[model samples]
Target: MSGLFVPMTKANGLGNMPDLLEQWAGSRSVARAYGRAGLPMEVIQFPETWIPVDAIRSLFEISARAAGDRCFGLHVGKDMTHKTFGLWMKYSVQAATLRDGLIRANQSSRFQQTGGKVVFVPGAQVSFWRYVAPPMQTSSQVQHCDHLIWPTIRFIQSYLGPLWLPEWVDVSYPRDADARLLEAQVPFPVRFGTPYLSMAIRNRDLSPRTPRPFGDGQRITFDAVRASEAAGPSNETLGTVFNTITLRLLEGQTDIDGAACQLGIGVQKLQRDLRREGVDYRDLLNRAKRVRAQELLSDTDMTVIDIALSLGYSDHGNFSRAFRKMTGVAPSGFRARKDQMQ
Candidate 1:
C-alpha cells in the first residue's frame, strides 16, 4: 500500500521507444542499450500486456541507457493516451471535469494498478495530486517515479486541452539526480527532495468540462474491462483479499462461500478473519459493486438492466436500491447526468 505498483501496460512505451530511438539515436544504439541493460533484443518488441511495476521500471532503465542522456521519459510520457491504460484510461478521460476525471482515474486505477493509489488534495487556489507509494527498496524505482509524474501531466493535458501546464512538479528524490532533458520539457519549475512526489495545478484549471457524446468506442472500452483484471496488490493482506474478491465479482462470480473455499477456509472462518481485520464481507462486496456500477454508468452505453445483470444482481430494482444506498443516485439517473454533462 505504501510502495509503487504499476501496470504492465506502463512498459508499452518501451516498445515504441526503440523505434523512436532508432529515429532520434539509431537502430544500432537501441540494440546496444538493451544489451547493456541486460535485456533481450526482443525487449524492443512491444506487446499489449500488463506487468509488475518493478519490471516496467527495469524496462524504463533499459530505454534510458539506450536513449543515453536524451529526454527519454518526457518523450514517452508525451505520447501517452487512453490506450496506455486501456479501459481505465478511456473511462477517466470521459469524466465531467479534470478533477472528476482524476477521481475516476483513481477509482479505476486499481483496475490498471493496485500497488499505489492517486491522492488528491484540494486547496482554495490550487490542488495537488500525489501518486502515493511505499518506501523504495529497488534501484529501478526512480524510473517508475518519473514515469508516474510525466504521464499524469500528459493525461491532464489531454483532458484540459493541450494548453494546460502544472504550477510545478515535485519529486521525492534528491535534486542532483534530476534529468536535464526532463527539466527542459517541463513548462513549470521542477523541485526535488520533497516530502511527496506530486504535481500542483491551479484550482481554476480543475473546472468541469463537457463530457463526450455517445460513441462506438464506449462499447469497445466496456468490453476491454477484462484487461484490467491483471492489476492487483501483490501481497496477501486483507485489502489484497478484498481486491481479489472484487475482481471475482466483476467476473460474474459472487459467492463468498466459494471464495472462502478457494482460500482453503470455511465461510465462517473467513468471516471471523474479516472481523479481526475490522472489515465486513458484505461491506466489501457493496464497495466493489458500487465501483463497478459507477464505471458502467459513466463509461458505457449499457442500460441499467444490463449493468445490474453484469454486476450479478437479481434485477434492476435491487441494483437501483443498492446503488442509491451507496451512491445516493439511481443507476438511470446517474447515467442521465453523465450523459447530460458530456
Candidate 2:
C-alpha cells in the first residue's frame, strides 16, 4: 500500500455514503463493493481513521457499477453535506468569506487526503479552484474526479446560495453521451477533454460575508479529535514526497534542495531515503516534470516554449530533448497525437 490515505471521514462521508449506496444499489451490492475493496463495511464507523486512497477509488468504481448509474459519483457528491468531512468542513464554514474559506480549505486539504492537492488560484476577474490528481496512474478516475468536483461546487454554493453557478467547469475526460447527464444538472457550461478539473469563480461573488459560528460542543470535539490525531505517528511517506515535488513543480521551482527544504529534511537525507526506497531523486523529478508537461501539452493552448519555461526548463530545446528522451515524442508531436485521438 502506498502511504497515500484519505481520512475515513472524507471517504465514507460520516456514514452517509454506505446508507446512500444501499439505497441506490442495495445492501448486497454495498457489501460486495466493500468486500472487493478489501474494506469491511464497519470501517466507516471509524471516522478518525485513514484508508488507502486505492481502496477509496475501488469502492467508488465498484459502487458506481453496482448502482447501474454512470453519474453515480456525481449523485454521491451531491448528497454529501458539511458533516461528511467533519473538521475539514468546519474550517471552511467558519471562515469570514467564501474566498477565505476556500483558501483555508486549500491549506488544510493535506489533513483530508494525501497524494493529491486542491489549489485555489485567486484573480481579479475569474479565479480558479483546481483539483490536481495524484501523479500516479489509476484504472478509472472518472468517478473519483466527479466525486471531487461536485463537493467543491457545493462548498461554493454554501456561501453564494444554492442557486449560484460557476463561470464554467473543466473536466479532463472526454465528452460522451453520459456527459449530458452532468451538463443537464448545472446551468454553467461543462467542458470536457481539458487538462484538469477546475471551476471558474467570479471575483465579485467572493466578497466578505458573516462567518458561521462553531458551537462550544462542536469546538471541544474538534479540538479533542485534533489533539488525539496530532499525537499519532507521522504519515509522511515517499508518496507524500512525490506530491510535494509535484506541487513545487507547479510553483515553478525545480531544485531538489527546495523540495527537501519543503519536506523539512536535508538534501543528503532525502537522497539516502529515496535510494533506500529503490528510487532515484532525479528520476522522480523527471517523472513529475514529464507528467506535468504532458498535461499542459494535451490540455491547454500554451505554446511548447511557455510550457517548458513554466516547468523550469531554461529553453525550448532542452525541454524538447528531455521530453522526447522520456516519451519518444516531441512536445508538439505529442500534443498533435492527443488532438488526433480526440
Candidate 3:
C-alpha cells in the first residue's frame, strides 16, 4: 500500500455534525448516510478515532441532501461548544489572550486533521486566520469549509462578545445556492471564489482579552495537552496504525477488523503493512492499552471497573491482571502513586 493512499482526519473535526443530522433527519437516516459514505457507524460511536477525509466529505454531502438544507454545516458550527474539539479547544482557551490563543491553535492544528494547514497571519491594522484545505476536489467543499469557518468566528466571539463579527469572511469555493444562506447568518460580508478560506479580524480585537472560565475540576491543563500532542503518532505507517488502535481502544473496541475499517483498508492488508514496519497488531494493541490505562488512572477519577470496560476488558480480574502485568502495579496502587507525586 502506498503511504499517500488517503488523507486522514480526526473524527472530532466533524464536530456535532452527526448529532445535528440526527436532529434534523432521523437516526435511521444517519445510519443510511454513513453507509452511503462508506464509513462504519463506529466512527460516530468513537469521535476520537481517525478516518479518511474523503469519507467525511461524502458524509457532508449526504447529510445536506437528506436535510434539504444547503447550510447544514453552518448550523452545526453555530451549535458547537468548546467541547467539540476537546483538549485542543481547552488548550487554546487557556492562553493569556485571544491572539495568543489563535497562535496556539495554529501550532496545534494537527491534533484535529492531517494534510491541512491553519495559518495565523498578522497585519498592522488587521489579522487573518486562514484554513487551507487539503488539495482534494469535491462538491461538498462549501459544506466542509463552512463547518470550519463558523466555529472559528464563534471562537473569536469568546474573546470579543456574542455580537462581535468579522470584518469579512472568505470562502475558497465559488458561489452556490448556500451563498445567500451563509450571508443571512453573518452580519458581515461574505466573499466567495477566493484563494482560500479565511476571516479578517481587526488587530485591536485580537489584543489581550480574558479567557472564559471552566468550573469543571477535571479540566486538563494546557501543558498536559501539549505533552500528549507532542507524544502523538509520527508520519509513518506504524504510527498511523498505532494511533487508530489507541482511539478504538477508548471505545472498548480492540478488533483488528475495526481498526482496518477505520483506516479504510482491509484486515489482511493492514496486517501486511504492519509486518512491513516490523510490528504485529497484537503488540501494538497491548502497547496502546497499557498507555491508555495509565492515562485513565492518573488523569481521571473513574473507577477501576469503568476504566477496564473502556479498554475492552469484560472481566475486572482480567483487567487487573493485565494492568499489573504491564505496569507492575495494580490500578488502585498506580492511581495512589500518581496522587502522591502530585
- For TM-score, the strongest prediction is 3
- Compared with the true structure, the alpha-carbon lDDT of candidate 1 equals 0.64
Q: State the weakest 10-residue window (summed lDDT) of model 1.
A: 1-10
Look at candidate 3 and tell me the lDDT of residue 196: 81
Shift of residue 254 alpha carbon in model 3, Å: 5.5
Ranking by TM-score: 3, 2, 1
Tell me how many residue pairs clash in candidate 2. 0
Any residue pairs clashing in model 2, and if so which?
none
lDDT of 3 at 57: 79
Q: lDDT by residue for model 3 over 1-342, one digit each (tens)? A: 356244667787788788888999999889998889766676665576666677787788889889889888878777776558768777776666779878878877777777777889999898998988777745557777778776888777777777888899999889976588889987789899976889899998877667555436355565676676664446457667877777667567899999888776899998888787777899889888988888788877889999999898987899999999988999999999999999
Predicted model with the maximum lDDT: 3
How does each model score on lDDT? 0.64, 0.72, 0.79
lDDT of candidate model 2 versus the reference:
0.72
TM-score of each: 0.57, 0.62, 0.77
Q: Which has the higher TM-score value, candidate number 1 or candidate number 3?
A: 3
Instruction: Point out the higher-scoring one by TM-score: 1 or 2.
Output: 2
Model 2 lDDT per residue over 204-323, tens place: 888759555543524433354355345223445555566556556655778889878756588898888777777777877887788778877976798999999988999999999999
